[model samples]
Target: MSPQPQAAVGAPLSRVDGRLKVTGKADYTADHDVRGAVHAVVVGSRVALGRITALDIRAALAQPGVLRVISHLDAPRLAYRDNPGAFMDPPVGERLRVFQDDRVRFCGQPVAVVVARTLEAARHAAHLVRVSYRAERPSTDLTAPDLPVNDPLPPQDYERGTPKEALAAAEVRLEAVYRLARVHHNAMEPHATIARWDGDRLIVWDKTQWVQGTQNELAAVFGIPPDSVRVISPFVGGAFGNAARVWPHSTIAALAARVTGLPVKLVLTREQLYHGVGYRPAYTYTLRLGSDRRGRLAGMVHGIRAETSAYEHFLEGTVTPGRMLYATPHVGQTYRTVPLDVNTPTYMRGPGYATAAFAVESALDELAHELGIDPIEMRLRNETAQDPSNGLPFSTRRLRECLRVGAGAFHWDRRAPAPRATRDGDWLIGTGVAVGCYDTLRLGAQARVRLDADGTALVESASSDMGPGTYTSMTQLAADALGLNMRKVTFRLGDSLMPGSPPHAGSLTMASVGSAVQDGCDRLRRQAIGLAVGDEGSPLYGAEDDDVVVLGGRLRVRGNPARTETYERLLARNHRTHLEVLGSFTPPSEPERSSMYAFGATFAEVAVDARLGMVRVRRMLGVYDAGRIISPKLAESQALGAMVGGIGQALLEHTVTDHRDGRIVNANLTDYLVPVNADVPDLRAIYLDGGADLDAAPIGVKGLGEVVAVGVAPAVANAVFHATGRRVRDLPITVEALL
Candidate 1:
């Protein structure tokens, strides 16, 4: 019989910081107690499009404890430079400098900031701060024809055979338009920043996903060296890509600190969150698909129009899956960004894939229904073992296996063939499934590892955990590589002072940062082994390097457990103080011929009430081929969390903007509904038991964070379609649409 695997890589270990988090010991951005910190609240423009005509700070300044009021009229002018590195994108139009100019391009734009000794005083003073603006009608609707289209990223176009020709000859074809509403990340934690300057150095505790990016931006804004800025974000409540960029509030906090000469804390009210940062742009997608009577896809043409701010062009990867996912020979795609008087959009979880999959997967389901074919069978027939776009073989693709496993787990054979056929007590019960796909990306990461003479090891990096068990995963990797117990290893991150690391987005933390930690620990262990084996005073001096193995913090010969010496004993005998190693992992330079991506299939069972336009997810099952599960418990939690987020996207999450004045109607949580505890249903997640080729990264692990939600919305939408014959292309399938 085979022996049990070691308790390291694949174990169901709990998060190392779980206790710290649950016990309120974790230090999130706003939780820090900065000495002599003052509260600052921002005053927003009431008009969407306007230029400030007059500024009144008399009442606000007279208020008690009001330290200062900085507006475009009274604020000191610093050198405003056009640096793309500082902003999310290159300043679209001479950079709308906050407080530098009085022109408001969008509603809720920060017109001024009120700093006070107390939070209440700051709130009162902010309300007292008044501004008059010369108003102008703004174009807020993305669908408006007058909106100018812009291309920020390089134009993307892919074609195999002429889609027009194929569609002309095809036996059957269907074309439909799909629209997705603008959505906010709406992370549990609102954007917060506490800025302080010590001499010439700037210290900021911010809730951000990219610490280095924030550091660079602050340095550029302050016209200081990058080393002079330090950003610390030890814990983040949640980002969902909202905190990925250095938002305008961060700059507001820094400016306040600079003006007041004291640390200033700026926490965006839930209402302010809607306009202060980025969001997933509203999208309009037109899909034309042609297929045979047997439901085999022949051709596809996709046209996309998404929203961006007038000042900056925000682009999402709308054309990616169209080129790579299936075996269609004739494919064409065009993606356009429509700039409106709104805040610029940024990368959300799964970004383009999540939005694109909704249209692609929904279209495929529609085609299957038109051909009178099973959706799973249709996908199976069109599955390409190699990427159809580039004609390159995948390192490892288990999407077919995922489908088979998911179908069995979901009981696809039991699904009724016709829409609205299955019902239970006025609830229409239907099952639907869709494919999930996301590219595996890795960036350069660095780490420092030190093994003390006391037999404990410490690992440090600048990467963040972001509620993904980063600390635990890195600790596990380091412990295994160093041949030490998990208890003897400590992993620290989320500080700019540590070793340089990549941004903790893109699901690349494990593949990139984990490799660096493993490399550093391995080097440290090898150094200890050399010292122990080479020294005459240490035990096993004559042992071969290969024969000398370290386990349980002890150096011993293979097959001789009793003839061993503790690492502490050996180090003390050799008079070696400690072993330290620094290592880095950089991604491959050249682009590969084939595409490597994590794949999954989500099956959702939904029960929709016929009379009321209410939908409830009854059960969800996700089968994933994400390569080598590191921690089953945490992976399951991640999958479940993503599924819940997808549920919100499908049924609840939508940011409503009052286009008349460009104010977000549903800015707070009460008005903008998300999934609550009562909305979540039974969720089951399964990871295929295997490993992928180690060509991409040393860990042979692919990313699973974004992939979990890529196809989820479509799965729910397809189920809703199955429950009711009427098709709803719009997002947040509301009761009005169903009625």
Candidate 2:
């Protein structure tokens, strides 16, 4: 078949849904209107690690418009069937069972729920219900030496060569500890769910990243057939992996709807979101490195400890970078999870890689300063030609290019090698750089496309758009593949009935779902070409199929533009109203032949007040080797948003927990600081032009959203060190630490 014309795929197009979003016309979960829907407010426990001694709901039931109150005493028993196929669920332990028992594992564990006619009534009644608990001190500290912890999973711990012996014989050695505070995903739209039951089938409007995953989870929770549940999530305000899992509140909403025989809507309060959803778990990383006199790495040892709830074990790709990022002969890693009296943590943006980069990159900088070598030079010396852990060649490894391009753009040649050597008045200014990487993950996906006789088309998949422009990007791919104008194609998503799709996180939506959409459109276009060429009454009826091409819904010979027929005329003459096709993309499952990953380099400049112990980021830039950007405008948006998040992680964001009672002290947005307009400075991103990674998927694109955030925190930390000549190991380089 002839190659389709390239018109829309790489064009810098604005989001198709931008107008609806800005005008408040987009319907998020809470905005959905449900007939006869009641409101529910959860009542939480006051103490962690306790058992409910007594409970009373008389006052709550007496309130006017109060429909019902449910607790362990009267709440019906749910099926709670096994959901082994749920996405990203912990493999070791069971999920929390809402209102099933009196034992409180953590503070803010929902003990009861109040249902009423209006949201106001639910709020008023929820506060009226009384409860008492037998409290005990909780183990909430990751640094506590005596805390009980589970042994690391096999994948979390690794070894290569003889690291200990090599480290002992190395000429130079450095050891440091880094701590990262727990952080929450403070998306603008709160997690909300509305559930309605018609007979035995369930319909749910939820805030989620994957509608199909949510539908399967709800089906398993209710012990019903998977087809009995339909999850609809047309628009997600923003979920950086927080909404990927099916939380207990969603089940609670369904349970209340079943019990009351009325549709129920539950919206987590702002404060409740802290304990309601998952977060980026705090980490304690101890790193020891050995290198030659010229700053070439020889060996490395890593000790990782993180927080997880006692009920389940959670792990990330925290130790993978140490094994593969650099070309080291000897590497050893050990990871453990400290069980705390808190909720289970989930993936937040960059997940494991961000935490690992902060430690590894900062340590490389320290080693470079010790050996009197430049930071960029240090990283370049240790760049690997193949995966150190598995010996597989890279599909596309561009860390060197990312660093070189970023240095040229950031003007790193102007930076001083010595800390505290560059200053302007009361401010000490310095520049720092770090490399970031995230695995290019691809999964099986499918999309459905339909072309109408009216010269328009519709493409759909069970994907989602949390912040990145999934709707727009898919439309671009379809428009290009089908030889149609962008305005003639419409893309739809976030419904379980459309087609199967992988989870929206991990930066794989475009590589997986977009590829499927492209395949479907390509097949539909070929079908049209065959139909036009075979019809005796059509123009250029004897034209070879390989020499024919479609553009603007018109079919013509390769060299003759005058002999062409519009899609409308061909379909009308054939007495066909529409054409439909299903597209699929399944990644190769054979043994690994290549290492696939997306990489970037981040550069940050910071200024520190000499007398006030304050650090302000002046400007930041990131250069990425993410292959074949489908939508340049959306890619820029993703890169800039990730940079802003990195700024927050480095200097502002921290989730403070009261260890005594396991309560989040900074549950509200006011106390949990993020980068505001005043805190954010100039930021820019540049995507290196490169060929597609055909090994990754048909789209030939590597993922972008997560890798952009990986190296941000460490770059800022390195900058602060350069400015003050003092290295702080912990995150959020606070004024107190600086002092």
Candidate 3:
């Protein structure tokens, strides 16, 4: 069959919803206008690791506009049925059931909720609700030597061959410890949920990336059927893996509505977000990598530990990259989750791969230096077309291309090889490079398409756009597949009532949801063509269905453009109101023959102040071999944002915990440092043209969001080391570390 003629795919088109967002017409969770909605504010515990001995809310109840104060003392018992989703999944022990008990697991744990007619009254009443806690020392310090080590569940911890013996016998050996600090999501829109219950049915206007996950969780908690609950989140300001789960505040909002017989809105304050939602857990990773003098890897051993909640285990794909990234004969990895008195962690943008890359990529850079090899050349030396971990052929591995393209684009050859060799005024300048990779993960998803007789189409799925341009991309896919104009195609998401979709995460939406949209549109177009051809009254009725092509509301014979009929005319004659179909994409049942992954190379130039111990990233560039480009403009934006996030992880972002009380010292944006407008400068992203991972999906697109961030932090860190000749294994390479 001939390749589909592309009209919209890969175009640098502007976002279809850009006007709605800029004009303030888009409705986010808290922006939803609900009638007679009351406000709810949670009162958090003051002390860490304690139980509420006594609670007092008389003053709060007496406050004006305050309807009721619900606490563990008088709160209704909820079923809190188990939801074992891997994304910040509930604890194996009892999940943090709202108001189910008086136990406090950490500071900022909700002790009570004050509901009122107005947000002001709710805020005032929440402050008035007093609490007394029986405090105890919290084990919040993850860096402590005595923290218990539990095996990193299955598939995460792996061993092959005699890694220890191989390392000991290797020609060159290098071992280093890398530390990463806890970091909050700090999405632009704080997690908000507005919930209402009527008889047995419930409705929620919330900010969530996974509407299905939230719907199921709410259904289980209320002991209602999944169909009884509806979740609508059509727009999200930005959620970098923070809004994927139904957090405690969402439950609190629903519970308050159930108790008061009125709709309740719960918007977590900036401070409340520190604990109310999920975060990237701090990790201590020790890597012992052994390679030959030519930089060919002999073996590697990874000893890793990351924080988790005391009640639940939180895991990410942190250790897999170390085993699969290189061609090594003997590879061994041991990962442990050190449960701490903290909120259970969830996926961040790049999630585990970013953390692992910081360690693995930086260590590789160190090994390159030790072996007197260029960093890019060193990585090239150990490149593998087959996954060393599972012995599967790679569907697409372009690390070498990324390295070569990025080096040329970033002018890598001009840099001096030695540390601190280049200088600008008082600034020590250096350049560094690293490789990033992420598996192209696609999940089953479905989309509903309806082509109306009026020459318009609507396609929908229960997905979300966390500033990744989902709306634009899906519209492009539908437009191309259905041969409709961009204006005639409307793609909707973030609604549980729409067709089922997997969570909008792990950079899976494009491949999973896009495939469904394409399928749906193809069927709808074919159906319309079939109707026109079957109708003897219609023009060109005898033409073969295969020869017909729909473009811009006109169905025409591909071989003869003159033979055509408008969709309106064809439908009017057939007496059909619309053509509708539900399209679905499911993962293949058999094991994949090849391991699919997206690859990218990041290069960084940094300048460090000699006396003040300050570091500034001068410029950065990333070249990627992501499969197919859906929308060039949006793809670039995604890449740039992920790179910015990587910069924050490498230089500034850190969630400081007062381990003495399990309190996050920098809970709000003001205190917590992230890369702001001034911090991001001269960043560029380039994509390899027309490359597609054949095994990933029909779209042939490997996900881009995660891989863009995977190697960024290490690239910056490597540059810092080259600039100052000081290797700081710990993340957010602080000024103190430089000194």
Return the TM-score for each candidate structure: 0.97, 0.99, 0.98
lDDT for model 1, please: 0.85
The model with the greatest lDDT is 2
Error of 3 at 415 (Å): 1.2
Worst 10 residues of 1 by lDDT: 86-95
Q: Deviation in angstroms for 235 in model 2?
A: 0.4
For all candidates in order, the CA lDDT equals 0.85, 0.92, 0.89
Off by over 4 Å in 2: 89-91, 151-155
lDDT of 1 by residue, 1-739 (tens): 1111246778899888999988999989999999999999999989889799998999999999999999887777765454565533343454456788778988888999999999999999899887998999988997777666775556655678899889877888999999898888888777899999998899999998878878887787777888999999989998877777687889889998998999999999989888888888899999999988887888999999998888877766668888888889999988888878887788788889999999999999999999889989989989998998888898778889999999998899999999999999999888889998988888888999988889999999998877778888888888777778899999999888999887787788888898898778777777777777788877678777777767778878787776688888977887777888997898888878557889899999999999996899999999998876777888998899999989988998888878888989999899899999999999999999976547667778887888988989999999999998878889988888898
lDDT of 2 by residue, 155-235 (tens): 467899999998999899999999999989999999999999999999999999989888988898888999999999999
* Poorly placed runs, candidate 3 (over 4 Å): 1-3, 85-91, 151-156
